[model samples]
Target: MVSTALQPVTLSEFMQLHNIEESPAWELLNGQVLQKPMPTFYHSLLQKYLVRAIDNANSVYEAFPELRCILSQNSVVPDITIIHHSRIPLGNQPIQGAPDWIIEILSIDQSVTKLISKIQACLAEGTQLGWLIDIQEEVIMVFVPNQPLLLARADMALTVLDEIALQLTPNQVFGWLKR
Candidate 1:
């Protein structure tokens, strides 16, 4: 979440300067470049398990880790980006639009506010669901368009896209790290 001091750059210019394959991905939000926080052990585990869970739940949608997506003026690399199989763009280019579901796992010392803003941006651009997983708190904050924020914990089932058949809880997600 460290912002660079360089002058603001457009999405095209930002993409030209930074490659998606770069480690410790960079994001363009509000025309400013920001580096994503390195993933912690728990963060990495959750991302792995969540993507697996999502992909296994249904074939209609697929989940990807750290996939860069271009949403309107901003470009972000969500921890996990889920999109319908039919909507997946061809070729080696970054995703051209917001994903169907955007998941962001909170890293140590990462700004929750900035993460929420990023999620909201995706939602504004037609993303159906957004999840902010707070490992320290053992809770997930769920965001959906025109819906009140939902806090899910313990055995509380999280909401997913209507077409997906996955059923998940915070405990199930965190439990992956225990193994």
Candidate 2:
């Protein structure tokens, strides 16, 4: 008797067909492959501040700025991914498991349809926190599983990532964009 085997489509396999060359700052999210654009002046400013702030806080967890990960069949590259020190996986590829926190810096290339699905997928995949930063609105939509999201304006403080007891004030974060 002969047996037939089934093959599964993996995110890594998908990326291979995408021409994903080596770039220090590239990521893939949910089959929607992309290379991060040259950070607009504002993007670079916010990214630097976020990385610094998280690093200085000294959490037991690790926070990676602009990290890439494979979420099921899709490749998601979040702006920042904070993973529990214990949960972090071992590998040279870096992101071996779901991150504890994910930050997506909204960009012109992203669509509303795309962002919502990716956020929902992350939440379901063991990511504890997710933030969608809308640069023009200076608004952030914070997501935590089984809870109402906390949306912040420039003045409000968002305690989305509580692992380090840190809260982000929108006005303060956006201020980094000032010319």
Candidate 3:
């Protein structure tokens, strides 16, 4: 006898089948359902601090956490997503296109490859900036279109959004984890 895995699902199917409003732990990516692990205290701390930093920054971009972004053929829930004021969605609806900036904080035992792939796809689709933050490593991988990847840590500042003046350093981001 042979064993095979079941096929993945499309975003619409996943949404129709799963009550995303009641259960927000699931995300759809390239016709596949991805279940994110429960966020830890450290993760929440980082998210809260980053959100505040971006929100209070001298810029026109608004920061949102765990917002579902609907792409051409995929749906993603980024840990932190930033969009310019001019491009804000019209009404109470999910974002219909790539976000201007995306930040994903590495969760415990999470696959970094999957996170990178999502970021790359967003960048290819028109996202201006992507960040893969590994709290365990205390480092941030910066991705920008037509530019070399930057590995920032310690005091190195990261340019979050071009339309915003928010620049955060790896140390500042990770410092929130400390009691």
Residue 6 displacement (Å), model 1: 4.8
Stretches off by above 4 angstroms in model 2 are 1-9, 24-32, 88-91
The TM-score leader among the candidates is: 1
CA RMSD of all predictions: 1.3, 6.8, 3.6
Candidates in descending TM-score order: 1, 3, 2
Per-residue lDDT of 1-179 in model 2, one digit per residue for the tens? 01111344357665566445444344445444445554566766777788788877888777776677666656666777877778666665757656678887787655655666777788888888888888988898888899898888877977656658666698888877874
Every model's TM-score: 0.95, 0.81, 0.90
* Residue 45 CA displacement from its true place in model 2, Å: 1.3
Residue 125 displacement in candidate 1 (angstroms) = 0.3
lDDT of 2 at 31: 41
lDDT per residue, candidate 1, 1-111, as tens digits?
A: 778747988887887884545688999987888889889888888998999899999669999999989988999999999998987878877788999999999998899
lDDT of 1 at 157: 93
